[model samples]
Target chain A: MSSTPVFITGLGAVSAAGTGCAATLESFRNGNGNPCTAAREETPIAKPVFTVGDPAAIANAEEMRTLRLATLAVDEALSDARFRKRPSDIRVGVCLGTTVACQLNDIDFYRELRASGQASAVVFDRYLRGNLSAAVAERYGFCGPTLTITNACSSGTDAIGMALAWLRAGLCEAAIAGGADELSRIPMAGFNALGIMSATACAPFDRDRQGLNLGEGAGILLLETDAGVARRDAPAVLTCEGYGTFGDAHHLTAPREDGSGLEAAIRGALTTAGCAPDDIGFINAHGTATATNDAIEGTVLARVFGTDCVLSATKGYTGHTLGAAGGLEAVFTALGLREGWIPASAGYKNRDTSIPVAPVTRMTNVTGRYALSTSLAFGGNNSALVLGRQP
Target chain B: MKTVLGVHGIGMISVCGRGIESHADAYNHTQSADSSSPIRVCRVADEILKDRVTLKKMRRADRFSKMSALAARDAIDLAGLRVSDGGIRLGIVVATAFGPHRATFEFLDEILDFGDAGVSPTLFSHSVHNAAAAYIAIMLGSRGPACTVTDFQYPFHAGLMTAAVWLHEQRCSHVLVGYTEESSTPMDRILAQRHRGQPSHEPVLFNFSPYASKMFSEGSVFLVVTRPDQGGVALDLDRFKTGNDRISGLGSLWAAFKDGGLHLPQH
Candidate 1:
């Protein structure tokens, strides 16, 4: 646990559901946010994915779509935090979580190089500019420690958790912690090979759901130290109370069927927050809509928070955004804390009978001080965060 | 006062060999870069696993994970600590630049050749960044917190900082932090093309000053970091500098720590 409060001062996201706070909120208000788009020539999986981003801008930047989405998300977050206008002397750091975009292997470039003995350096040069967080820090003129975490799906949530540690260790006074990933053929085919990519819009927690629909986006949150928040007079979006991350040495792709890893993570978060399980108002589950993932996650929730917990899994609305899911859902969790309500789990029509609890099927109002957001990624990594409303 | 932490033991598997004697000899002899593709990790891990009865399960594991598991096992043995506890107290941090590139390429090749339907699940599963860390945990029976971070510029620094924080918070009794780099055709070519100007005959310090130091190597480095007061070489962390060719002087750091911090390298 942190000695002082760490607040989420600003939030930004660009996802398949929508872009920017207003656009995303409006999409949710209107209901049914997962809008499908045609697959691109590069990512020719044939399955309609919830691909979202500015294609022209992404092509123009050529710095990589992940970097561009990060820039957009960071710009919006800075503007929201009012850091764009007010310059402070506090040390700032950047921690990002990413997957497909962060890797250096460019299949097309490598193929061309292999075939013709020559390939353009556009992709290679971008890869050399450093990792995702370093690019972000250079763009924003940040001087503190910058790290890029590549822990698959839990990267974003774990990134935020690590940033909190930085604050506690006096390594940085403020931080931009989040995740971003661009849709690419590599992961699409990989997940499809894994048999987890759904042909239709994902139906998280629904008994008859096929699998996840791949999505792309960025989610960023600006965090501040207590003194820095007071000195800068920054408004708190919500308070990050606790964070816990653990791994299961089980299987490479499959989570522990007993849900031990996830259960430990949730218990760690709750313990650090100094809160009981009943104190949590709602939960935003990883909820990838895969039979294995949803079933394991539900059992873990029941084991930790009892059967009557009010929870929702938002992947149905945004699709499974891969690495960005954690950050995107963190923003959603923060919004739930701020607005005191959580939207229904979109497309969840039926529930599995084996699970003790079902997802929140309707937009539900809640009155509580805290909410929990959980993420379970590939490689058996499980992470949970406890967030509290501003007092 | 805060409990200080230092690197207690070091384990590595480079093109040179397994332990410190081989690495030091290679460093002194200007060991020629392996011209072979995908620079392979030595059989130190296989030898270590020879005595253990659980080798059957790891037969299908990728080389990247094998290198990490071997390096971590050696480091823990050197440190003489028990990390294979049933409790959720240990922390494992693995840092890498490429992160299982061989497996990744193989997986991608399957996708390109056979489409998604024909790709193997095993290949796809091992392609993830954290698979190596997971393997390390499994081998050690460590049910602790684990994470994998990737970066080309400063991977070891990031891992060290995270380990320092974990020790500071007393979240774990000790942390096994490791850094691994694998040689791939593209990476080797990029390094060769970029660093052609540097003197390649001698093992000069990889300096990042001015602009491009232009060198990349394949190997793994593991450090058993514990509380500073518990006794080890006090690592001299320089003020964060921009990228350079100066290689990480882990060898010097290990020597200084093991010999009481007298021979800190100038580089």
Candidate 2:
């Protein structure tokens, strides 16, 4: 945990589960999930995906869908933080993580350019203006350090960690940090090409798990220093206690077989928090249901937290949201810490004997102060966050 | 006590060439004005990327990853540091304005030519923004904290800030922080269209005007930063500056470092 107090005063999330935190909690409580097959127009492959309902309803005319998702979550976070408008007294920064938003992979625009040697500048201009953090900072008129972390799947977790670093460094008093990525055909195609897309819904850690299903959403946290929280009189129920990230340095797209990288990250987080493995109440795993990912992550989790450690993989509720996975899981972990309960890890059936641990099959109650959320990404990046509730 | 960071070593690759010495040579010698092409872009040469040893580890890596790995390796070598020697925790922070667009476009071409199902998984994997950072870590066998940050403005500055935080927080013993960008055809076309009427010239340094003639350039620059107590050349992070009218991404920083624009600390 950081010596300097960093509180998550507010939480905002929008996903296939629903548009707000309340709706998502309701879905979680009911143990229900919403996943549908991709429309033929979206992609030729028939893969299940969890997409936000009616993105157009929340988006402006000319903004990217990814930005629209981010805007919705930001609006909700601000409202949850009890700020009617931008706070004038504090230096607020914007740090966001994203994968699709950082790429210039507009298929139609590229097709046009490749065919006619010239394409419309509209898409290019939107990309130029759509730096995730820059757009959010410009929209709300924030004047502190702003950055967009593109560390693949761990981007969101790393973004939040970076914000904690910023606050500890006294560069910003408050920050809006998390991640947002839209469900686009580009990644769908890419993952399909990689043969990691399950035709049916994802079943993380299940014995017969196929692969991961893609999802789209945004998850944002209103993080503030102790002074900023006191200034706003915000309810500081949850705190970002510790963060640790380590690279495997092994493969471009696979976890290290030995799982030492992930082990170090988990240990690093625990060391930072000054807590023992037994103190952690539960873990929200980065269980993408792909065979290698589950095996490696499961082995590591079991090694660190013991085979009997209470854990759940929420990716079944929200398909693997890529960069947004860490943010959404972080918010879910904070909620778990605050609500004193965690939903069942959906879609899990029998446990894989090859892996030592199994996820919770039903709703469970917990009474610990801290919970861990872990994310593993392409490029062998593993990140873990320890969230705590005020005693 | 305030934490101070020093630049222990620097490695860079640009259109001018590779290494700090090449950059210094380019900084001292002025280039004759070339008005040959309206689309002014200073692209890294294929010759500069022909390192056999580095290429052996990164055979399938794209140009973006290639550029980033070479520079990062050079920085470690110049620092006379062996990551495997001591239990030195070496963290890496790679910053980029646009990341690996050429690979992205190539993946798109696969979709257009061979259909989505037929696309190459290797291409898809390499198209991601962090592939460069991952390649750097693998080439050096570094297992420390690695992050890749993106921004349209001040990416390198943001990277330096992240590195400073890591150093101060004692997350790592040394940090290889850098920025990498690659010139792509689609981006070149966009730039040509955006700057169609303006006169193109070699980018002028230290001209902070809004309307200065600037050319798009692509390369990678990595700096080995450690606690000031470790000692090399002091870098005052407080005085670091960034602007839209700068020469280019890492090119501008390399020029400033070589020109002595960044003052050494009094300590």
lDDT top scorer: 2
Candidate 2 lDDT over B1-267, as tens digits, reads: 234567767888866678866765655654443243336566677888989887788888899999998889888887888998786889999988888988999999999998877889999999999999999999899999999988766677778878888988889889998888787776666666766677555543222122334666677778999878877556666655544234233344455555645543221
Question: lDDT tens string, model 1, A43-131?
Answer: 55677587674566456445787788777788888878888533558889898899876575577876776566454567777776747
- Model 1, residue A173: C-alpha shift (Å): 1.5
Instruction: Give fnat of each prediction, in order.
Output: 0.53, 0.79
- Docking quality of model 2: it rates as medium
Q: Give a tens-digit lDDT track for model 2, residues A92-128.
A: 9998999999998888889998888786778887887
**DockQ for candidate 2, C-alpha atoms:** 0.66
Candidate 1 lDDT over B1-267, as tens digits, reads 142456667777765667654666655654554455332112222354342443345678876777777778778888777765454267899986668877877776776678756888788778888888888877877767787887776677677777877777666767898877665565555555555466434432222111344334556768887768666666534532213334446666656756776344554
Cα distance off (Å), candidate 1, residue A149: 0.6
